[model samples]
Target: MVLVQTKIVFHVDELNKWPEVLSNVTNVLMDLAQHDDHHIQMVVVANGDGIMGYLIPSINDQISELAKTVEFHACHNSMVSHGLNSARIPSGVHIVPVGVIDLASLQDNGYRYLKP
Candidate 1:
């Protein structure tokens, strides 16, 4: 059997523009779902002020549903600083210790790195 992996890391921590980041994130996820043929693993490393941007209902829903087909995660550090509980972020967004590490490890294992 063949194992296929599509790894995506949403690095929203480095941006100052929340709306633009949200827009781009949603679009990238949508494109990934529509274009990919193998298994997808999506990890969102939301840090800094961008945490609030991902709390949008529409974006959350899109990502939540996509989680059924893709692995989803958010940085616990960001959740703490933003005063957001796991319940507040999207339903399928898993909490991770470090987003950068997660992304790096996945890439090192052969998952592609994409930033939109």
Candidate 2:
């Protein structure tokens, strides 16, 4: 059986309200993945100061749950600039070479972009 999928890449470039961002995005993604016909694939590319959101202690469990649906990525370049090392970032968040280029490639490959 063939399945249709909705792909998404959420790019976060600022260190805005981390909790709200994840909460809102998770709500929207869960709603999108509700129907059997819609197979939602999502990844959040966090760069700049936004990468710190994934390390919040209050949302550790939420991040764990989010990982089940959303793949979280951190920008290594941003990490260096922000003085953050891999040892400090959460385990589940994958560290990519560059977040902007990754975001661009995802868009080029047809993943819808949301920077919220």
Q: Candidate 2: which stretches are off by over 4 Å?
A: 1-3
Off by over 4 Å in 1: 1-8, 14-44
Task: Compute each candidate's TM-score over C-alphas.
Answer: 0.64, 0.86
Estimate the TM-score for candidate 1: 0.64
Least lDDT summed over 10 consecutive residues: which range in candidate 2?
A: 52-61
* Residue 116, model 2, lDDT: 67
Q: What does the lDDT read for residue 73 in candidate 1?
A: 62
Error of 2 at 35 (Å): 0.7
Residue 111: error of model 2 in Å? Answer: 0.5
Q: Each candidate's root-mean-square deviation in Å?
A: 4.0, 2.0
Alpha-carbon local distance difference test for all models:
0.65, 0.81
Q: In order, how many clashes per candidate?
A: 0, 0
Task: Please write out the lDDT profile of model 2 over residues 1-116, one tens digit for every residue.
Answer: 56777788887777675666687767877787576666877888889888777667766677787887788888999999888999988878889999998999889988999866
Q: What is candidate 1's CA lDDT for residue 39? A: 58
